[model samples]
Target: MPQKQIYALPNIVSPANPVIFNPDICNGCNTCVEVCQIDVFIPNPEKGKPPVILHPDECWYGGCCVNHCPLPGAISFNWPVQQRAYWKDKATGKVLRDSQ
Candidate 1:
């Protein structure tokens, strides 16, 4: 008989939160819930309540929620430290990149 080998994986903590919703600014409009491509936000159970982040790990950092939010400064995204820095050049339509 042959013996089977088991592998273990190391756990690493992420430094940034993919999406942050400010309850003070959030109007609970559900715009974020509708705009998220990954379905990260869900409507709160109570009416007129802020949506909840259901799947933070699944967020793609697409900024759809932030772009579509009706309230200013309601949503924000922070890239994980492990990922590279991303920026956009308005003059040439180029995406800028850098290390954290």
Candidate 2:
């Protein structure tokens, strides 16, 4: 009999928390893990994968992870609606909400 091998998937299936990472865009540089002040992210054991969000609730929303990423949009925040602002144009009278 032969034994089957198990493998860890590096792709991010969904947004784990407020800090969302695009797995396709992420180069697995581990920069996000290093820059996180609160230790919210951990390096993925599997190479070439985005870091895991270990402490999602602990994130301070400081934007350090996003600002430091070499590739734009590799890391982005799913800002809570409470924290997001909606503004209306005085002339257009149209309200615009922050992008998701």
Q: On residues 1-98, what C-alpha lDDT tens digit does candidate 1 reach at each position?
A: 79779568565334436767788898789998998898987899876777877777788888999998889888777677667668999999999786
Top lDDT model = 2
Each candidate structure's TM-score, on Cα atoms with residue i matched to residue i, is: 0.63, 0.77
Between which residue pairs do clashes occur in model 2? none
| Span of 10 residues, lowest total lDDT, candidate 2 | 11-20
TM-score of 2: 0.77
Q: Which regions of candidate 2 deviate over 4 angstroms?
A: 1-16
Which structure among the candidates has the greatest TM-score? 2
Q: Which regions in candidate 1 have their CA more than 4 angstroms from the true location?
A: 1-16, 84-100
